[model samples]
Target: MSASPLLDQLIEALRCLPGVGQKSAQRMAYHLLERDREGGVRLAARLAEAMEKIGHCERCRDFSEVPVCPLCASPARETQLLCVVETPADRLAIELATGYRGLYFVLQGRLSPLDGIGPRELGLDLLAARLAAGDVGELIIATNPTVEGEATAHYLAQLARQHGVRPSRLAHGLPLGGELEYIDRGTLAHAFGSRSEIPS
Candidate 1:
């Protein structure tokens, strides 16, 4: 039997989340209704609040309520050292694993021509502008080891060279095709410690 209109809408809305299938959505909907209406209401309110308030940081492209993220606004961070990564989560992982004091540029995604995600889509123009300002002396690429990530890293390395900024890549201790967020802290620390310069 088809679900009631409200139930159907709730299930569909839940499915909008990544990796949440119909069954999972249905289960979540039911669980929320059955055991935790208060939590469900809070979740809905928080989602709405986040959607209304959270936006990409002007400088780093990471999620932030203000125009600039805390990292970009911080005075202690090394502004001359820049690290590029696929997402904000990767940046957080790096922060947790290593003592990297550099500033970061979050791509929000990697190069994927088939998906129509090119340089513009990944905010490379904004990054290019930052590099052209000549503040960044060295760029460290910490994108995942996936094929698309590799392509993005190479492209950014070229862009850095064009702006006279040295480019480096995280070491190979991170397995091929592995995401930075999933790597162990020890491996991530090692990778950051052993990062090598990309040949211009």
Candidate 2:
């Protein structure tokens, strides 16, 4: 432990961040104290303010300072297409990588019974309500290609069908420009199974 109790507490606090171990936390604490005290103060203030003010968006459930996020508030976004993502990060990834102009419904997490994350935990009820409103024609399931994600996708598809909304999954297969030999067996198998005919 450090000589200063506050410093030790700071190191422990830094360790709370994802992938940050004891050594990394200690290093960060030392750097903040020695080299970047002003930066550290700014970081602390902003972090505190964010924790206090940032909340989930009412419509999309993404982190927002306001009730409805800017994207959901925008009238230009396609109301007929509602993309379902596992997290705000995933939504951001889609927004950055694709030309998708549709709205979103952030699940926050996939259905993991063992972890105590279920339909209610992921806000599926809210999504169901939105689907039932009949504005969304398509529910784009953009969950990750994991076992839990697949289960979550299946559940979402059922929910969409119940509401008469067409459900579509993000095509999972091979990455562009990647060689077949370098790809994993599961990916290769999936790609082969999902092979589509070349458009004339």
Candidate 3:
């Protein structure tokens, strides 16, 4: 028998999200319809509101419906030291660790040439402009240690040199190919404490 259009529509729409396959989508749709209509509507409404309002920070490229994120808005966030990350999730991880009092620059993505994400697409030019502003004294490259992460770090290091800013990278203590989101708070703190200067 054919599924009704409304149920199928939500399942199909949710499947567009990463890793939510047709099976999981069907399960979610059923749960929403059968068990949790109020919860489902709430989730859908909140998702819509956030998607419509949240946007990128013009300065550091983090999430900000406003002109700047709350962190960037704070004058006490040690703007002299900027930590570069690949996504907002990394920011949450670093925030959880709490040793990093610096501002952040989210690349928004990595160097995926196959995916057509180049330096320009990753906001490297805007980063270059920010570095040239002379407000920052140090740059911490906190991209994960995957192949793409390493490439992104290398690219940022080169750009940092061009702008005459000191750049550093987290020490290789975390496991290879591991994400910051998975690393524990203590380890992340230690990594921040022992960051090494990027060679010129």
Per-candidate TM-score against the hidden true structure: 0.80, 0.94, 0.81
| Model 3, residue pairs in steric clash | none
For candidate 2, list the clashing residue pairs, or say none: none
Model 2, range 48-129, lDDT digits (tens) per residue?
A: 9999999999999999999999999999999999999999999999999999999999999999999999899999889999
Q: Where does model 1 exceed 4 Å of error?
A: 2-4, 174-200
Report lDDT (Cα) of residue 81, candidate 1. 98
Q: Candidate 2: list runs displaced more than 4 Å.
A: none
Sorting all predicted structures by lDDT, with the top scorer first, yields: 2, 1, 3
TM-score between candidate 3 and the true structure:
0.81
The number of clashing residue pairs in model 3 is 0
| lDDT by residue (tens digit), candidate 3, 22-42 | 899999888888999999989
Find the 10 residues in a row with the least total lDDT in model 3: 1-10
CA RMSD, predictions in order: 6.6, 1.4, 6.7
In candidate 3, how many Å is residue 166 off? Answer: 0.8
**What TM-score should be assigned to candidate 1?**
0.80
